[model samples]
Target: MGWIEKALMRANRWHFVHSYRTIIAREKRKHPQDRERALMGAIGAASRADFAAQGDAQVAVLRHHGLSDGMAVYDLGCGIGRTAQALLRDGWRGRYTGADILPELVDHLRAQCPGFTAIVQRKLAIAAPDATLDMVFHWSVFTHLYPEECFLYLQDIHRALKPGGRLIFSFLEFEDPAHHTVFQTRTANFAVNGWSSVLDSFLHRDWITLWARQIGFAPPRFTSGSDTADHPAFWQSLAVLDKPAPA
Candidate 1:
């Protein structure tokens, strides 16, 4: 299953490219046998699925923001296609594209459901061209991105979206001064693009809002409460951005 996990994770390579160093390596060390650790990992995955089933909050937020049936939707960094599956289950009767950086994930998705066109590609380099999609959703994807890479993807998102399209994403934020210094100095990997960094890149509401404006998006909304948002939870945020209507 190590190989399987590696392959599935590889599709979401950008997020894990040495970003999981401290965690995975530590697990391997603690459980040199790795069997016990693997079981724990399996449990964790099952728990995530259960949490999604109980209530896919992202779906609720998307629908509230204008998502509807038959819209061409792209689930970027779709790990194992859970959200994609949830979308289908949630009455999203649209042309769906689940794009990721790992071929293994697409393979698993295909093996599980051979209906949609799953593309193993980077979010910054989308499969469809400009103004092609009705909406683009990146649930928890941005939480894994480096600040620089996040900016790049925001630009890509601007180009990929159609006029009047919407883009939603979530990130980590430093709710207090204690987190500010951590995120600023930490470097998860040499690539300079990873989540293990100490800062709440997602939680830093101001910088993200300003950055979105730079990417042609209108102002962004954020906070740390019901319907607003908080941090360190399994999901740090659920940001929503929309494209302008054509002239």
Candidate 2:
């Protein structure tokens, strides 16, 4: 891209981030005491019922990807324990740790799901010790982050995962027709309404493959967003990366 195109992209990103922060501040002011509302707003969830349903579907996907008893799992950007709640309800006997940038969400997760560890993180790094986790997953987290930001987080996730450990994350890609709808919606919102908190970002498969190779992760496996028996409501694409075990 040319310098002019780069400048335009930067300006657009700034606008989206500013608009999103404004929306979050407004929600906090409007519902200072309503934890559920705050949590839903932060994660863009419509209702507890919908949240629970999605969480259950996510757990199904995780199970399909080899989630089982006694494994240590990390939930990055784990908003309000959506997957954690589902895992608990399904009687999953695993050490589950969740972390998010929002303290209120983390606190609510702790209150709602006892025995699970929740942390409020402000950086792109994971809080776990090196090579301690069996699995780490992000649901609708990378869709809002820039490519560089996503790469940094993946690097940290690699550090936190044990050899051969798997990492699963959902992202939006332009190759999928359905994902174009997300971009269209955000564009219309910004054009007509002048502001929208939604920062829908799309990633290319080549970019992910390159990042995985550069970070020493095993080749990534991609699952189409349309393949949705496990995570029916989520339309974002999924990528699975594994840390290579020593020879």
Candidate 3:
């Protein structure tokens, strides 16, 4: 790209960040009395039913991808224990830890699902020891992060995972028609209004595969967002990257 194009991109990003912060501030003002509500809104879950439904769908996806008992698992960007609660209800007997950037979400997760380890994640790093986890997954987390941020998280996830461990996360892509709606809405908002409340990032399969390979993971597996036979409500495209076990 030319220098002028690069400069324009940076300016747009700065505007989006400013608008996002403004929207967040407005939300905070709207929910001064209820931190939990504000946090839930930020994550796009409006009510307990909505949250539980989404959690159930996430649990289904995890199970479909071979989530078995006794595996040490970490839920990155684990907002308010959505999947954790579902797992607990299903009598999941495994070592589970949940982490998120928001302390209120972590605290609420702890309160909602006692005995499950939930911590406030300040940086784009996992707290677990190296090679200790069986699986690390996040739903609707990477869809909002920049490409570089996603790459950084992948590097840390590789460090935290055991050999042959998996990183499963949901994302958005332009290849899927269902996802184009999200792209259209966000882009239209930005183009017409000059800013949008949320920043929606999209990734391509080729890019993700390249990143995974560069980070020493096996070729990543992708699931279409429209494939909802298993998890009806979870529509975001999913990717699974497994750390290669030693020969």
Candidate 4:
């Protein structure tokens, strides 16, 4: 990391520790997805509200290209299986596998969403056969990884996907110059000892375009963020990494 970036990160950490303690390393996960939905409803309490607002913005992207039953979907960072549940609830007749790095989370989804497979994926690896996943989603997952890790995982995600398969994800990208700036961008208290508490916390914008090309992801579409910020760069991208060449 360059000196300025390192210094900026250090400054952010100090600010959080000295001032933003309450929000830093928060006591509880603020966004609560209704766990009950994992059992009965398609969306859980944690992200239902936002997903509701975006209007399943990600799913709409896929449907535009044609999404239907008989397809298989893999939720890469399937936290609490909220998105997975939502997809199924929408009468998306297809196979669903929700994978996350958390085993407890996998158990929750497995018990709650019967017939839904919750695979424990600790690293970037997708625990599926090559070219198995027909439709995949990282959801808000990439918003958490380090840029380098994001690149690696993107490749991994590509490997697990079938050629011509679709991969859906969102980015904290600076696709437009209208927005995407950090002011008083001090460290979120999710930092420890001047380091990040969450993996995706320190992300900037450039990584999006770089990683997309590295993974061979094809042309992408951008959707504006539904927030007051109104910064065009706070946009979410729905990209389909082109199918990899056969091994």
lDDT of 3 by residue, 159-229 (tens): 99999899999998888888888888988998999966677899999999999889999999888877777
> What does candidate 2's lDDT look like per residue over 143-163, in tens digits?
877788899999999999999
Residue range 1-247, candidate 4, lDDT tens digits: 9999999887654331232233221323342453343322222233447544343544555566567889888888776665665665666778888887655557776875788888876666788888888878776666655566667777887788888887767655554343244211324432435644433333343455566676776655445454323222224444445564555
lDDT of 3: 0.84
The whole-model lDDT of each prediction reads 0.64, 0.86, 0.84, 0.58
RMSD of each: 8.1, 4.4, 4.3, 7.8
Query: Candidate 4 — which residues are off by over 4 angstroms?
Result: 1-58, 174-196, 201-210, 226-235, 244-247
lDDT of 1 by residue, 1-247 (tens): 6999989877555554344333445545756774434323321233445635523565766676688887888878765566665676786777888887656556655664457778777546667888999888776566666678788888887888998988877665667443354355664442476533322244467777888888888777553323343222333445778788867
* TM-scores for the candidates: 0.70, 0.85, 0.85, 0.66
Q: By TM-score, how accurate is candidate 2?
A: 0.85
Which 10 residues in a row give candidate 1 its minimum summed lDDT?
A: 36-45
Give the candidates in order of lDDT, highest first: 2, 3, 1, 4
Model 1, runs deviating above 4 Å: 1-15, 18-51, 176-203, 223-225, 228-235
Better of 1 and 2 by lDDT: 2
Residue pairs with backbone atoms closer than 3 Å in model 2 (clashes): none
lDDT of 3 at 235: 78
Clash number for every model? Answer: 10, 0, 0, 15
